[model samples]
Target: MVIISTENYEKIVEFCSKFKGLTIHCERQLHKKFSDIDSQVLSAILSKEWQKHIKQRHHIILKSSRIYLQEYKAQARLKGDPFILLQIAIRENFSPVSLCRILLSVEFEGKPKSVTNEMIRNPHQIPDPLLAANVLNCLLNDKSDGPITDLKRQTIGEDYEIRLKKLASDAGLNFHDEVYLRRKGYDKTPDLKLAVPCMFRGKIINWIESKASFGDMASHQQYIKDQLLSYGNRFGSGIIIYWFGYLDQIGRCPENKDCIIVTDDFPKKDELVLINNPFGPLLSSNISNITNLL
Candidate 1:
């Protein structure tokens, strides 16, 4: 994940907002236009912008489906591109398959789900051959709610967790991962917790968290309230990895007053100064002396 300056990030976000009606095909054009940005980072930024477009225009989409649907359909029919029409009107990247549900719900006299299933599982079974043809073309390109899109996100997230854990292991650090901590009846564990604390950028880091998305201010704040602060309180200190990237001003948030260090990826082995215990030399000497006497 590349660290983007706040000004530039906002500019990219503003640029992306115009692409609400388009799909990732537009993202490809954007990459060529903004070649300096990492493609993955740009995609991550586009993903966030798309989500915002969807949320902000959700009520509008619903309204168009209910009130202005006939007008939208007339325009879609006139233009021969229902998707583009709905997209322009509602400001969302929509699937014709999902749009079929919205259309069938009204047109078929309360019989949408059955046709929706056909559109999904057996498009050939859909009665209208023209619609079936349209569906066949759009279904493969539909990244909005398709399984392929969701699975890629899930796989990326799982893979990053594995990378974080492996990095901890390669550093000769012993740590309990979330699975083990969960089994041990602990709640709110990070991705990994060190057996012995390690110094990272002068702070003793006790745990690590891995995230697969760009950390915008809203999502970052939610994570701080939900996970980061909890991990710090339970484990003393920790690092949160936003593998894709984050807002530049994220480091100055009030929640950062605690020991949660934000990073884009796992640090190399040398970056972490492994410590047997975080206690000072006096405490270590006293423990050694006590053990010797015993």
Candidate 2:
């Protein structure tokens, strides 16, 4: 989880206090506009106008909010209600100025109107320190399914791969790191590739993608669409490890037969010694259900 400083919280509160009213765009409406207009044309027009708008507003944009918006759009499409996802920020006490700035930056067609005064007669307020803390927590931690930095993500991913390699070695299994698929003279690589021909009913598990953060439904879906599906197409099956156990209670992947394993579910070194048998009862008991589909 990400932590927000007291100074930053105060700044957010001060920023939000300035906006008397907020104008919001609907997700369904925005999708319609996206369908009608060419994405490149829309992006150019919005970028040109938004730069001017921000300059006139005399407000410095938050880089984190800007990055958040990029992922938020994809989440909106999945939820089928952009407003619902926006509400997460709103309820978290996101700066009205920042929210408005981000939305205006990506001005969609149709000129969607803000909610009427009847719905929100007054601007949102952060009344007390406790409330402010809650707001700050939500802003930084909620829906932080995307990485803050590519370098940091790469580091975490490498660490996970190393750990998996150790686990494979302990189990007397072969671990191939950064293995690539060669098709028609082209190369496509996955993070970690393991082939345990003698383990788990002789399954040939090809790829293992490690995610450092909580694999929420939105982020998981994006992973499936962007990376996992392509791997599945090239290689028959693979495993995805959510280190935080975010998807443990979320149940099986309804969309695919591939395995979704949470690292947290496995017993630690102090609890029980992992054996050389790859399909030992201890390990099999936890993953057999998911790997069965593989």
Give the top-scoring candidate (lDDT).
1
Model 1 pairs in collision? none
lDDT of 2 by residue, 135-240 (tens): 3333343221112223455786677777876765665555456644343343555565554322232334556677655454546677777777777777556566
lDDT of each: 0.69, 0.43
Question: Model 1: per-residue lDDT, tens digit, 14-94?
Answer: 888666445557678779878997888888888777767656755655666755457554654676652443353334455
- The estimated TM-scores of all candidates read 0.79, 0.39
Query: What TM-score quantifies how close candidate 2 is to the native fold?
Result: 0.39
The residue-level lDDT of candidate 2 at 42 comes to 29
Q: Which ten residues in a row have the lowest lDDT in candidate 2?
A: 115-124
Candidate 2, residue 203: Cα displacement in angstroms equals: 5.2
Best by TM-score: 1
